[model samples]
Target chain A: MGLEHRAKWRINIYAWLLLLPSLIFLVLFTFYPVLQTVILSFYQADLGSPEPFFNGGDNYRIMLEDDVFWKVLTNNLWFALGTVPTSIALGLAMALFANKALRGKGFVRTAYFYPTVVPMIAVANIWLFIYTPEYGALSHVMEWFGHGGMNWLGDRTNVMFAMIFMVIWKEAGYFMIFYLAGLQNISKELYESASMDGAKPWTVFRRVTFPLLMPTTMFVLIIAFTNSFKLVDHLVIMTKGGPDNASNLLLYYIYETAFSFWDQGMASALTVVMVVILLLVAAIQFFGLDKKIHYN
Target chain B: MRTVVKGLFSVLMSMALITGCSSGNAPATGSQAGAGAGSEAAAGSGAGKASGEKTELTFFYPVAVGGPLTKIVDGMAEEFNKANPDIAVKPVYTGSYQDTTTKIQAAVQGKTPPDVAVMLSTELYTMLDMDAILPLDDFIAKDGGSEYVNDFYPGFMANSQVDGKTYSIPFQRSTIVLYYNKEAFKEVGLDPEKPPQNWDELVEYATKLKKDGRWGVEIPTSGFPYWMFQSFALQNGKNLMTEDGKKVFFDTPENVEALQLWVDLAKKHQVMPEGVIEWATVPSDFLEGKTAMMYHTTGNLTNVKNNAKFDFGVAFLPAKKTFGSPTGGGNFYMFKGIDEKKQEAAWKFIRFMTEPERAAQWSIDTGYVATRKSAYETESMKEYVKTFPVAAVARDQLAYGHAELSTHNNGKVTKALNDSLQAVITGQAEPAAALKKAQEEADKILAPFNK
Candidate 1:
């Protein structure tokens, strides 16, 4: 019994030795910065001050009062809602279609996944050319139909939708690969049994395959949710949160505040708010949604 | 669990590494060139002790307009280093004016600021607030004093001074000029040589020039709407900010009328496109025959000359109260915390780069207006102007130029006006209402500085 306990102690030591690198990295890069942000949110700090003057939640108060802050938060929420489910649905649709045996299967698969390999800035540049006012591809198509297309990136009414459409085009293929992996993991026997039971394809997918794919769906949900908050590169290139801040998202706004305006305190407050929202989503996924998801 | 966390950390690190590498390298001249030169200077510092160890100066610059500016800047630095062995100058090409300021500000905070940098002239207040720069009054006194300073155009000087003290020297400077397609003017039956001279003429020419699915003019409202809007406001007999940098006149009736005229160009007159014009692509659109005329920085003259397939004319922006444009572009600034020796070295380099011959060469190479009047008097500049008379318009417009709007908390104040300008141009808000709200915001931001 004593020898076994000693062995267990050795194993614990080994485990901790292996974990040291990541633990130090996580502490330095992630957790410490997060803590610093929370601390900074309470201070009236510019960059490089040895000690930020204490401000007693003034940054938060200012954020609450700023109309643009609220607008950007709402924009981010809408961007998330607008992009998340649509991409996931499209991803699942593509994955299901691509899972089947068909001619020129490899070519189709490559075509579907092509955007995932290109950088977001390059994608935005191409989309910018396509959306250019008169001689753009969309304009050419519109001219053929006896109608002039509205400016895709200039008008407040159309800019967000334009950005969302391009994001979906770029991101759906990335999520599709995950779903494809999930679909491949499903047993062939289950589908065979469903067919033997005379189940229609849709019904079989609904009752059996979907329930089995629940775990992957939840994982993808978490990924898509996190990505919506983090992805603001396209905004930098495409719209720059313009048209009266109509298309501004929270992350991009934070970047502009911190970098352009050089207001570290306000940016930290904004970052704290973002972290809280992310935490709430993560809590829901891990504690509530995970309960309904079955694992093998 | 340990492996998973490790894998995640590795992925994050790699992603950051990739972005960092790409952003620094994709731009033409990377700061790594400066870093590489610093180590070389360090190696020679001990060997060259008989004369004096060289003061290694890192000079960061930003290229706003399209060109091979990075190559020109690097070549200029190489020439300086070769000529003055006591001062080894390393030039870094940051991405844009905005990016350069951000990098400098961050470097100041981190306590590793560059010895000198060329940032936007309007960033004067921000740098003063951060205490990141040395006032140039002493340097001016030490180096030929006010005579040297007086040689620069007062229009460019207006933006470089604060509180009657000089803190920067104008280098690559510009003003907004009207770039019109002579072909389009001829086609519209307007005199190809005589571009619009006033507001009414601009509208009249624009209306006549509008034909077959192309707009007449494009005044960009995206990247620097506030800069473009300043032209309209100045022409309407109003300046956006006071010389004191303490007050703004954003909500004045004249300014409102100016902004209204801008909005009316798209909505009421239908002379320009319906929504915002992009700054970067306006030149491209003009080249593509999508627009007959564009209001843009004179810095784009070289780019336009290269890409334009037809005859083009550069004119002073159409007048209202008077033909006016705010002088714009980067100015050389020395950072604080450097020893006097290093400061002297930086000042010497500035003088070298701004000498008449070099300034003329820089003006001919890049399309910036020569900062010094004497640069234009140089044989090189005179020859270049004789060959391309269109280049002379920006130099002449300096008589009507003012300092670009700069106040304490300049970035925030500029954003307030920028957002309001965008709001008005995009038809989200009426001109008077938007300008009033913008003034209120600017007041709130500037209040602390005033106090």
Candidate 2:
């Protein structure tokens, strides 16, 4: 018993030795910056001003009541809701479909994933041409399809969905890779056992396959939700958060508030709020997935 | 768990490593031509001798000439080093006007404040108001006050000065003017020399200018509508903001009427393109003659001169109540916390860069309006003088020109207005509702400032 305790102590020491560098790094980069941002959100705009001061919760109060701030928040929520599930579902759908035997399967998979490899900004340019109100290639294709063109990203009513469509297209392929991994990890023995019991494919999938893929789904959903809040490059090029701030997500608003508006205080406040929101989601993922996680 | 945390940290480090290396090499591959243009500016200057001896000054500037622009700006350090033998100037190319602002805040908070920054004129007021910049009244002592002040056109000065103290000097500035395709005007049988004088006339003229396979007019619907709105509101004798500057008063009758006038040119008239997002290469539009009239900066005249396949003429934008246009350029402001020596070095660079002869050369080379009156009197100015007389108009309009409704939070409120303007023009909303919503939104946006 003494030997076991001694051995455990040695292992604990070893483990801490290995973890020290990361702990130090996290303190320096992530945790410290977050602390700094929180501190800054309380201060007025004197990050480098000749006179800097702490203004209590004034910045937070301002952000909370601001109309455009609420609009931007709503836009972000809409963007997240629009982009996240669609991408995950489509990704899973494509992954499941592609995991089957098919002719030229590799080529088809490669073609589907092509948009993911391209830079978001460059792809946004192509989508801009597609979203143009007149003589855009997308509109031209629509015209050829025997339909009149709708201004994809230009009209305020149509724009969030338009951006969501582009986001789904670019991001679904990326998310599919994870789903593909999850699909590949499922044991063939389970399927064989289910088949021997005269289980249908759908029944087998519902009972065994999906539950096995739960961790991956949870991971993918967390990532997709985080990304939906973060990604707004296309909005920068295509809509510029307009025709009336329709596509202005939280991060884009943070950028606009900091750079375009030159309000670093409010921007930092917005950033803290976003970070808190993300942390809540992360917390949910952490606790909710722990029970369902089956390593074996 | 220990290994997992370690792995994540390593991944993050690798990401940082990749980002740093890639950004360092960015100028080599991406935007090299703009970088090359910046290099010409930095080319002649030599870096300071040894690290300890040189007073290091960091600078940020946005340039049309990319690579050469940095080199030219850093060249100031070299020139200053050679002249003073005590200072080093490191000029950072801060991509666009927007990027410079972000970097400035980041760098300052990071405790490595740049000694000098070449800021957009619109940016100067907010920074000055925020106490982000150091005033240079002492630096103006070398030149005579009134004569020196009178040298540049009045509008140029207004863009630089706030309250009573001068905060910035015009570097490369321009006023928005009408760059019309002479060929398009001729095709429409409208007198190229006789431009419209009112909003209705502007609509009529644009309608006439519209032709097959091309647009009639294009307003860069994204960024610059504020300047145009300010111009018209000033012309209409309406203030976009109150004097104390802590309220939303843009919904006033005169401003509504003025904004309606401009919006009518697009929505009701259908004479202009609906959603040309920005004045992305306005001269290119003029060159292609894609639009009959290009309402853009005087800084773009060189581009028009270079690329146009057809003849073009510059004309004053029509006025309603008073003739006016806002000054749009940049200012050279020294940031705080630098040693007196570094500040002096920055001033020296600004002085050399803005010398009448140098300003003239820059104006001739890049089509930016010369900020120095003496430069306008030079032989180089004679040709553009005979051709456009815009320098005079831009100067004359200084009495009427004001900065865009700018405050620390002006960016949000202004964007709300600009976006609503686009919404109205694009038929997303009617003008009355759009303006009403914009006013409501802007009030909510400005509520913090009011408090």
**A1-296 in candidate 1: lDDT tens per residue?**
69999999999999999999999988877886677678878998753343569999899999999999999998988899999999999988988888784887787678889998898888889998888888788889888786564677888878888888888888898888898898888889988999999999899989888888899899999989988888887777777888788888888888788767778788889888888998999999999998898676
Give me the runs in candidate 1 sitting further than 4 Å from their true place: A1-7, A47-51, B1-52
Residue runs of model 2 more than 4 Å from their true location after superposition: A1-3, A39-60, A96-109, A145-151, A188-211, A260-265, A289-296, B1-56, B64-68, B71-87, B211-213, B238-249, B273-278, B281-290, B383-402, B419-451
TM per candidate comes to 0.92, 0.82
Q: What local lDDT does model 1 show for residue A27?
A: 83
> What is the CAPRI rating of model 1's predicted complex?
acceptable
**Candidate 1's chain A scores what TM-score?**
0.94
Ten residues in a row with the worst lDDT in model 1 chain B?
Answer: B1-10
Interface RMSD for all numbered candidates: 6.4, 7.5
lDDT per prediction?
0.84, 0.70
Name the 10 consecutive residues with the lowest summed lDDT in model 2 chain B: B1-10
